[model samples]
Target chain A: MSAGVRLEGLRKSYGAVEVIRGVDLDIEPQEFVVFVGPSGCGKSTLLRMIAGLEEITGGDLYIGERRMNDTDASRRGIAMVFQSYALYPHMTVRENMGFALKYAGVKKPEIKAQVDEAARILGLDQLMDRRPKDLSGGQRQRVAIGRAIVRHPEVFLFDEPLSNLDAELRVQMRIEIARLHSELKSTIVYVTHDQVEAMTLADKIVVLRDGRIEQVGTPLDLYDDPDNLFVAGFIGSPKMNFLPAELSGGALTLVEHGGQTVPLPPLGRAPQEGERVTLGIRPEHFRKEGSAALEVDVEIVENLGGETYVYARQAGSDVLTIATGGARGLRQGDRMTARFDPSDALLFNREGLRIR
Target chain B: MSDVAAHRLDPEAAEPSARAALRGPDGPGRDMIGPAVKYIVLSLAAFVSVFPFFWMLVGTTNSSYDIVRGKAWFGDQLLVNLGNLIEQVDLPRVLFNSFYIAIISTVATLLVSSLAGYAFEIFRHKWRERIFAALLLMLSIPFAALMVPLFVMMASAGLINTYSAIILPTIANIFIIFYFRQATKAFPHELRDAAKIDGLKEWQIFLRVYMPVMRSTYAAATIIVFTLTWNNYLWPLIVLQTNDMKTMVLTISSLNSAYTPDFGVIMVATVITTLPTLIIFFLLQRLFVQGMLGSVK
Candidate 1:
C-alpha cells in the first residue's frame, strides 16, 4: 500500500548558501521515520523536498520506483500535513477531507466513502460540518491528518504537526499518529526539533545537523551508542554529562574530578598514553554501587515521583547530573561520591569523534 | 515621630511626574476621556459624514423653490421631482446603460487586477518588481493627464461613442492592482502548495483556492470598483458622444447643466444614482467585516 522513499546525494542551495548539503538516505516502506534536528539544521526543508514543496537543488529523489525530482507533487503520490494544518478556512471538515479526491476526478460516492472512512478513523464524524476556525487545535489537526488520509497517498510527510498543540494534546496526538502509521502500514516521514517525539514515534531516527546526516539509528541505539558527541548530547533527555579526562598507562584519570581515576577497557583502536579525551556518562548511569567513582559537590536536586536527579559537580568544574531511583535523602552542599560501571563510560577524542 | 517627613514623601509620591505628560499631565488612570465625551465626538463625526446624503435625501422630497430656500426637512414634492427627473432623462434606459457598463467593467477589472496582483506577488521576478513599482508610480499620475491620449486610442480603434471606450481604458486600474497585490501578500503560501499537491494546475489553483480563500478581499474590491465605475464622469462624458450611451454620472451632470436647471430634479437624479452604491455597500458590508476578521486570523 506504500512505497519506500529514497534520497541520493540530495542537496538544496539558495544561490551561495547551501541549506541542505549532500544527504543520502533510504526509508523503508511501512517504516515510521523521524527527522530530528535543531533549528536551521534543515530537517523541515528535507521533509518539504521529499513532499515536493521545495525544489531539489541537486539530487535524485525517488518515491516508489519513480524518479520524482521533476514530478509534480500531486503526481508523486505523497501527502503532507503542514504545521499550520493548511486547511481551507471556508470549507467544512468533510469538504476539506474530500477536496483533493474530488479534484482527482473520483466519483462522488467513492469520495464520500473515503471521506467517511477517514472521518470515522479520526473520530470526526460528528464534526464533519464544522469549519477549521470553529474546531479546537487538536480537532483541527485530526482533520488535517484526515485530509491526508483521503488522498490515499503512498507516503505521509508531517512537518511539526504537534508543535502547535498543548503539551497534553501533543502527547495524545503523538500516540494517535503512531497508531495511524501502524494502521495504514504506509511509510511516514516526520520532522521535529523535539528528541522526545522522535524517540517515542520513530521506528528509525535520522539525526540531522547543519544539513548533514549526523547519525541514523533506532532511538535506543542512538541513546546507548551514539557515533559522535552531537548524537550523544542530543538524544538523552538530561543530556549525557561530559568530564574532561586523560588516558595514561591504560588508565583514565578525571582531570577535573578531584583526582578520581578508572581503568580503560581495550577498544577497537585505543588512545595513546597521556592523550586527552572526554568521558560521557548518562545521568541515569550513576549508581550507589559500582566501580569507577568521582566525588561530587551537590548544587541542586530535582525529585520526580519516580526518580530523582542530582545535579552536582567537582570543585571548580561544570555540573554533572546523576539520576537515582526514588527519593534519596540528598541536599545541596552535601559532598558525596557517585559511582558508575567502568564498561558504561563512553570516550571521545578531542575532535569529538568516538575513540572506539 | 516622623510626621513631617512622611508628609513630604506623600506629596512627592502623589505626583505622577515619573510618568510622561502625554497622558494629559495626569496618569491614564485619571485622564481617560469619559464615554459621554467619546459618544459626543463620535456622533459629531457621524453627522458630518452623513450630512451630504441627508441633504440629498431632503432635496428629493422638495421643489426647486424650497431647495433654493435651503429647506432641510422632507417636503411633499417627491412625486413631482421624480416625474420631472424621468421627463428630462430617459431614466430607465440611462440607468440600464450605466449598470451594464459598470458591472461588466468591474468584473473584468477585478479579474485582471487580482490576477496581476497575485502574479506580481507570488511569481516574483526581477522585472516584475520593476513593473510593479512602475504601476505604483502610475497610480500617482492623474487620470486627467492620460485622458486625451486614451480618447485618441479609443477613437482610432473606432470605439468612440461605445461602452468599450469607457470600459477598456479603466479596466486595468493601477490602484486596484496595487490593492490586490497588497492583499495578496497576506495570503498564506501554504494554501497554494496544498492546492498544488491536490493536483490543481496553476490557473486552477488561482481560481479555486485563492479565489475562495481571499473572498473578503474580492468583496471589498467589488464594492470599491463598482462605486468608482458607476460614478465615473470625465472619460465617459468625452467618449460616450450620444445621450443614449451616457452613464448615470454624465446623465445627472447634463441635467445639472441645463440653462435653467431644476435643482429638485437634479437632486432626485443624484439620489437615485447613489442608491445602487448604497445598496451594494449594505449587501457586502457583512462580507467586508468577515473578510477583515479572516485577514487578521
Candidate 2:
C-alpha cells in the first residue's frame, strides 16, 4: 500500500550553513515526484532527510499520519536505491534481496517467495545467483531495485539510480522505472540532477536551487509556465533564450540590438513601462512565419539528423538558439530572420521573477 | 640497472618464457625486463626471508655438536632431538597451554578490535578521532613501559601464573584496531544505508552486511592476531611461573638458558612453536594481501 508524505517547514543546516532551507511539500499517495536541480542544490539532501538516512535538523515529516522525524531509518517504511546501486558485493542477488527479511525473522518460505517474486518483477531470475561485481551495470541496478522491492516499502526513494549507466541503458531503465511505478503504484520521491529524467518520470517536478524550491509542476507545466527564470532555464533542453529588454513605446525594445522592438501580449502582471526586463523565448517556439521577427547572424548550425538548431546572435548580444528544420542549408555567419508569435514570449522582471 | 639497460637496447632479445609466464592477458607494457628482473629479485627476497626457517629445520635434524659446527644438510638425529625435546619439556602441556591462550586471545582480540574499528569508522564523531589519535599514541609507547604496572595489576588480582594474566594485556591491540578502522573506511556506506532501509538495526547491519563484506579484513586480522599472540614471548615469560602453565615460547626460552643448552632440542621446539603461525599465514595469505590493499589504498 502506498503512503502519502507531508513535509512541513523542513529545514536542514550543517553548522552555520543551511542546505535544505524550509521546504514544505505534500506528496500524494502513489505519486511519482521528482526533486530535480543542479548539483549542490539540496535535492539529494532533501531526499536523504525523507529517507531518515539523515537526521532532520528541524521539520515535521508525516508518512501516512505517522510523524517520522525521530523514527529510525529502518522503521520509516521506505526503500532507497542509491546511485552506486549499493548492492552487497559479497552476496548473490537472491541473498542480497532476502538478507534483510532473514534478519527480520521472516519465515524461510516467505523470504524465498518474496525474493523470487521481486526477481521476476525485475527480470532478475537468471541473475539471482550472480554476485553484484559479476553483473553488468544495468543488471546490478536491477538487482538493487529487486532488493528494495522485496521489502515492499510504502515509499520508494531513488537517488540518481541511473546516473552510472551509459546513455542507452539510462533511457531503457527510465522507461522501465516508469512502467514499474504504474504497475507497483507505490509513492516514489526520486532525486536527480538530470532534468530529462525528471521530465520523463515525474508526476510532479519540484525544481530547486540554493536550498529553496523554485517551482513545482508537471513536466509540460514547468516548461510552459515557469514561475521564475531558473525553472524556465532548468526544465528544457536547448534552453530558453534570454534577451535583455526595456519596456518602451508600448513594447519591449531590445537593449542590446539597436532600434529592434518585439510586441508583447497582455499579461496578468505586466512590468512597469520603461523598466528593464528579460524577454524569454524557447528555441522551438521560433517559426518561419509569425507576428514577431528578429534578424540574427547564424553563429553555429547543428545538424542532428531530424532537427537542426541554428545558434544565432544579433550584434552586441549573446548567441541565441533557434530550433529549425534539419539541413535548411544554413551555415555559420549566414544572416537569418527568425519569427515567433508575440504571445509565446515570457517576460520576467529584472529580479528574474515571472511577470505572468 | 646494467641488466635492465642491456635488455632495453635490444627489446627483441627478451625472454619469451618470462613474458609468457608473468604477463596477464590484458596487462600493460611490452617489455619482459620489468617482470624478469622482478622474478629474480622476488625469489632472492623470498630466500633471504625464509633462510632462518630453513636453517632451523636443518638444525632440528642435526646433533647439537654438528649444529654448532655449522652443518647445513639434514642429519639423522631428528628423532633423538625430539626425544630430548620431550624430556626437557612437558611437550603436550606447554603446547596445550600455548594453543588455548593463542586461540582464545586471537578470537577475543579480533572481536574487540574489529568492533572498535568498525564503530570508529561507521559512527564517526569528533571525539572518536581524538580518542583514535590517543590510541595511536598508545601504540607507539613500548609494551615494556606498561609491563611493570601490568604485572603488578595481575599480581594484585591473584592472577599470577594464570592464562588470563598472559592473555589480558595483549587483547586490546591498538595496531589491529587501526588496521580495521582504515579497512572499514573502504566499506561502501551506501550498503549500510540500503541495509537500514531493508529493516536492519545498526548491529545487525554490521554483523550481516559489514562483516561478510569485510571477511578479507578479518581473515588478515586473524592471521595477524594469532601470530602475534602465539609467539608473544616477553609477557608470557614474565607472567607464567609454573611448569604446567608455561607456553611453548616460555618453555623454549627456559631451555635456551640452561647451562648446557640442547641446541637441537631447542631447534625442534622452535620448529613446533612456529608451525601453526606458518600454516595460518599460508592459508590466509591472499586475504592478508587484499586486506592490506584495502586499508592502505
Candidate 3:
C-alpha cells in the first residue's frame, strides 16, 4: 500500500518572497527520506507541500505515478505527526486515536480494534483513558504517534516530531520512530534541522539550503563524499574545515599556513596551475602519524570522556580542530604538529562545489 | 581551635547572621495582617455589588407601597404580586418567547462565529487578513447607528414581527466573530495540519475535531450570547409589534409604564427575566474562566 513520491520543480511562495524555490526530488516506496537544513531554509514548507497542507505556487507533484497537485490533503493517502504532538487536549488517548478513523468510514468495532492495536504498538494502552494534558511529554508524543499509526496511511509525514522532547527523550523517540518505519514499512518523509537525527534516521538524506536541494544521498555517502562545501560542512558535527590553497602542477599549495603543499589526485577538470581552491578536512580525519603535518598551537582542549577535540591555531587563522583518541596530555599554549593523509582532504572551488 | 571552640559555645553567634537579618524588627504576625486587610476589603466590595440583587428578590415579596417606601425585608405579598403579574401580562408565553429567541440566537451565533473565527485563524491569506482587520474595525461601529438600517432591511424582507428578523441580523455579529478569532489564537495550527492529513475534509475537521476540542470556548460564548439576546430591549421592542410576540424584557418594561404601576409584580418579572442568564453563568462559570485563561495565554 506504500507509494513513491516525486516532485517536478515544486515551488511555494508567499506573495513576492519565494520560500520554496523550485525543488525536485524522487522518494522511493518505503524509503525514509529526511529533509534537513537550517531554519527558514524551506524544509518544513517542502514537507507541507508534499502533505498537501500548503498550496503549491508552481510545478507538479506525483504520488505513485498519479499527479496529485490539485488533490485535497485528505485524499493524498498520508498522515503527519506534528512537532507539538497536537493531540486534542480534551479527548482521551483512545478517542484521539479513533477520531480520524470515524471520518474514514471505518466501522465502530474496526475503529476500536485499530485504536487498540495502535495503543499496544506504542505502549499507550494504559494511558488510553488519559487526556493529553494529564500525560507527560514523552507519553503525549507516543499518543501522537499512535494517532498517526491507526490511520494506516500509505505515506507518513513528520515535521520535526522530536524537536519538542528533551535531549534524552529525543534519542529514545528517534529509535522508536526508526523501528516504527521498519515495522510498518511505510514510505515516510521527515523534516528536521538536527543533523544527528537525519544521519541516524534517514535512508536517504536530502540536504537543502536557501530553498534549494544541495545534495541527496545515503547518510554515509553524504558524510564521506559530499558534492559541495556546504554539504560537507552541514552534514558533520563540529563542521568541516576549509583552508585556502592555490593549485600548482596537480598539487594544492596552502597560502595561509606556512605555505604547506598537498598533492591532489589527477582529474579531468582539475584547476589550472595557480588557480585558488579550498581544502576541506573533517576534524576526525586528522592523524597522529602521517606523511603530511602542520605545526600549530593548541588553544583549547575539550575532553569529552571517550574522545578529545583539540581546538588549535596555525599562522593567523583560528580554524583547526583535531580529534584524538582518549584524553591526551594536551593543554593550552602547547605547540604541536597536527598531521593527516593527503588523500583524505577534499578540494573545492571558489563557488563551494567540490572538485572530485 | 580555641576560637572555634569559643564560637561553638555561643549558639547565637554560631548561627548565620543572614537568619537574624531576615527576621527584621517585625515578626511573622505583622505580615499576616496585610493579607487579612486585603481580603476584608475585597469581601466588602463583593457584598456591595451583590446587595442589589438581594434587594430585588426582597422587593418581589413586598407590596408596591412598601417597596417604594424603601422596605428591604420580605413581606407577605409574593402571592399578591404573582396574581397581579398573571393578570397584567401573559407571563408563560412571554417567557417562552424570550427563551426561544435567546437559545436559537445563542446556538446559531456560536456556530457561525466560531466557524468564521476558525477560518480566519487557520486559513491565512493576505486578502483574508485584510478582510479580518476590516471586520475588527466594523466592530467599533455602535449597534445604535445600524439599528435603523437593520430595521429597514428586516421590513423590506417582510420579517418585521418574525423571530428570523431578530436572529438573522444578529447572527453575523462582528463582536462575537472577533471574540472567537481572539480565542482561536490559542488553537494550535499543528492540529489542523494533522487533521488535514488524516483524510478528513475541512468541514468534517471543524465539526469533529475543532468543535469538540474547543468546548470551553463554546461554553463561554454561550453564556455571553444568551445574556445578550435575553436582555435585548431596544431592538426587540422596535421589531416585535404584537403582545403575543413580546419578549420578557419588553413585557416587563411595558408593565412598568402604568399610571399606578405595581412595583412588586415588576420586580418579579425582572427576576424571571434575569434568572435564566444567571443560571447559565453559574452552570458554566468554571469553563468561562478556563476558556478566558486559554485565550489570554
Candidate 4:
C-alpha cells in the first residue's frame, strides 16, 4: 500500500551553510512527484532527507502519519534507486533483488517468490543469474529497481536514476518507471536535473532553486505559467526566451530591441508604469501571424525534420529562440520578423517575481 | 588530372613500394634492434635474479668445502645437508612456532588494519582527517626509533618472551591500514548506502558487503602480512628469548652466526624458510595483481 509523505519547515545545514532552507511540501499517496532543479539546488538532499538517508537537521518529516526524523533508513518504508544503479558487484541479480527480504528475515522460499515476481514485472527473468558487471547498463538499472520492488516499499525514491543510462535507454527506463508507479500504485519522489524527465514523468513538478522551492504545479502549469523568472527559464527545452522590457502606459516596450511596443499581457495585477521587467516567451509560442513582431538577424537555424528552431538576435539583445513549425528555408544572416501573441508573453519584475 | 599526378595520389599504387620499404633493411628490421636490446637486458636481469636461487640450490646439494670452492653445480650432499639441518633444528616445533606466529599475526593484522582503514575512510568528523594525518605521520617514524619503547612496554607487561611481543607490534600495521584506506576509496560508497537501506547495520555491511566485495584486497593483504611476519628477523630475534619460540628466519640467522657454519645446512634452512612465502605468493598472485590495480574493478 502507498503512503503519503509530508515535510514541515525542513531545513538542512552544514555548519553555517544551509542547503535546504525551510522546505514544506506534501506528496499525496500513489502520486508521482518529481523534484526538478539545477545542480546544487538541494533536490537530491531533500529526497535523501525524506528517505531517511540523510539526517533531518530541523524538520518534522512524516511518512504516513509517523514522524521519521529518528527512524533508520531501512525502517522508513522507502526504497531508493541511486543514479549509479549501486548494484553489489559481488552479488548475482537474484541475490541482489532478494537481499532486503533476506535481511528482513523472510523465509528463503518467500524471498525467491518476491524476487521472481519483481523480475517478471521488470522483464529481468532471463538475467537473474548474472552479476551486475556482466549485464548491460539498462539491465543493471532494472535490477536495481527490482531490488527496490521486492521489498514492497510504500514510497520509492529515485535520485536521478536514469542519469547514467544512454539517451535511448533513458527514455525506455523513464517509461518503465512511470509504468511501475502506476502498476504498484505507490508514492514516488524522483529527483532529476533534466526538466524533460521531470515534465514527462511528474504528476506534480516541484521546481527548486537555491535550496528553496520556487514553484510547485503540474507540467503545463509550470510550462505555461511559471511562478518566477527562474522557473520560466528552467522548465522548457530550448528554454524560455527572456527579453528585457519596461512597462510604459498600459503597454511594454522591449528595451534593447528597437523600442518596439506591445500591448501588456492581461494579469490580475500589473506593474507600475516605467518599471523595468523581464519578458519570458516560450520558443514554441512564436507564430507566423500574431499581433506582435520583432525584426531580427537570424544567427543560426536548426532543422530537426519536423520542426525548425530559428535562433535570432535583435540589436543589443540576447538571442531569441523561435520554433518554426517546419523547415522555413531560413538561413544564417537572413533577416526575419519573428512574431508572437502579446498575451503569450510572461512579465517578471526586477526582482524576478512574476507580475501576475 | 595528369597520369603522373594521379599515380602520386593513388594509395593503391603506393602500396607495394610502402610494403617493400617496410620489409627493407632500414625499416621492419631496424625495429628489431629495440626489441633485441630489450630482451638482452631483460634476460640479464632475469639471470641476475635467478642465479642466487641456483647457487643456493647447488649449495644445498654440495659439501661445505665444495661450496667454499664455489661449486655451481649439483653434488651428492643433499641428503646429508637435510639430515644435519633436521638434527640441529627441532623441525616440527620450530615450524609450529613460525606458522603459529605468522598465521596469528597475519589474521589479526588484516582484521585490525582493514577495520581501521574502512573506518578511517567511511566515517566523517572534524577530527577524522587530523587523526588520519597523525597516523600517516606515524608511518614515517622508523621502526628502529620505536622498538626500544615497544620492548620496554612488552617487558613491563611480562610479554617480552611471549609470542604476543612478536604479534602485538604488527596488528595495527600503519602501512597495511594506509593500503586498505586507499583501496577502500575505490569501494563505492553507494554500496554502503544500499546495504543500510537493505537493513544491514554498519558492522554487518562491513562483513557481508565490504568483506566479500574486497576479497582480492584481503588476499593481497594476507600474502603481504604473512610474508612479512614469516621473514621477520630483527624484531623476533630481539623478543624471542627461547630457541623453541624462535621463528624460521631467526633460526637461519643463528645458523649463519655459528663459529664454523655449515654452508650446505644453511642453504637447506634458507630454502625451508623461503618456501612458505613463495607458496603464499603463488596462491595469491592473480588476486595480488588485481588488488594492486584496484580491487573494485
Per-residue lDDT of candidate 1, residues B1-297 (tens digit) = 487566445644434653344344555655456876899999999999999999999999999999999999999999999998888889888999999998999999999999988898999576997888887888788878998888788889999999888788778988888888888888988888888888889999899889988888888888989999999888888888888887888988898888988999999999889999999999999887765555426
Candidate 2 Cα errors over 4 Å, as ranges: B1-44, B295-297
Worst 10 residues of 4 chain A by lDDT: A50-59
DockQ (C-alpha based) per candidate is 0.71, 0.62, 0.63, 0.80
lDDT string, candidate 2, B1-297, tens digits: 598877755535667754544454643555567898999999999999989988999999999999999999899999999999998788999999999999999999988888999899988576988999999998788878989999999999999999999888877889988998889889989888888877778887888888888988998999989998998898888888889999998888999999999899999999999999989999999888988788322
Residue pairs with backbone overlap in model 4: none
Residues B2-65, candidate 4, lDDT per residue (tens digit)? 8877766664566687655545657667769989999999999999999999999899999999
Best by lDDT: 4
Error of 2 at A31 (Å): 1.0
| Model 3 per-residue lDDT tens digits across residues A1-356 | 78999999999989899998899999999999999988889999999998898899999999888898999888887888999998877788998899888877899999999999999999998998988989988998899889888888888889999989999999999999999999999999999999999999999999999999999999999999999988998999888878899988767888888787877744558887898899888888888877678888999999998989999988687569888769589999999888888778888898988888
Q: Which stretches of candidate 4 lie over 4 Å from their true place?
A: B1-32
Off by over 4 Å in 1: A255-262, B1-40, B292-296
Give TM-scores for every candidate, taking all chains together and pairing residue i with residue i.
Answer: 0.91, 0.91, 0.90, 0.95
Question: How high is the lDDT of residue B220 in model 3?
Answer: 89
Local distance difference test values of all predictions, in order: 0.89, 0.90, 0.88, 0.92
Per-residue accuracy of model 1 over A1-356 as CA lDDT, tens digit each: 89999999999998789999999999999999999988999999999899888899998999999999999889999999988898988899989999999998999999999999999999999999999999999999999999999999999999999999999999999999999998999999999888889999999999999999999999999998899999999998899999888987788988887657787744788898889999999998898878888888889999897999999988878899899889579899999888988688798999998877
What range of 10 consecutive residues in model 2 chain B has the weakest lDDT sum?
B18-27
How good is the docking of model 2, by CAPRI class?
Answer: medium
Candidate 4's displacement at residue A154, Å, is: 0.8
Q: Please identify which of the two predictions, 1 or 2, would achieve the higher DockQ against the true structure.
A: 1
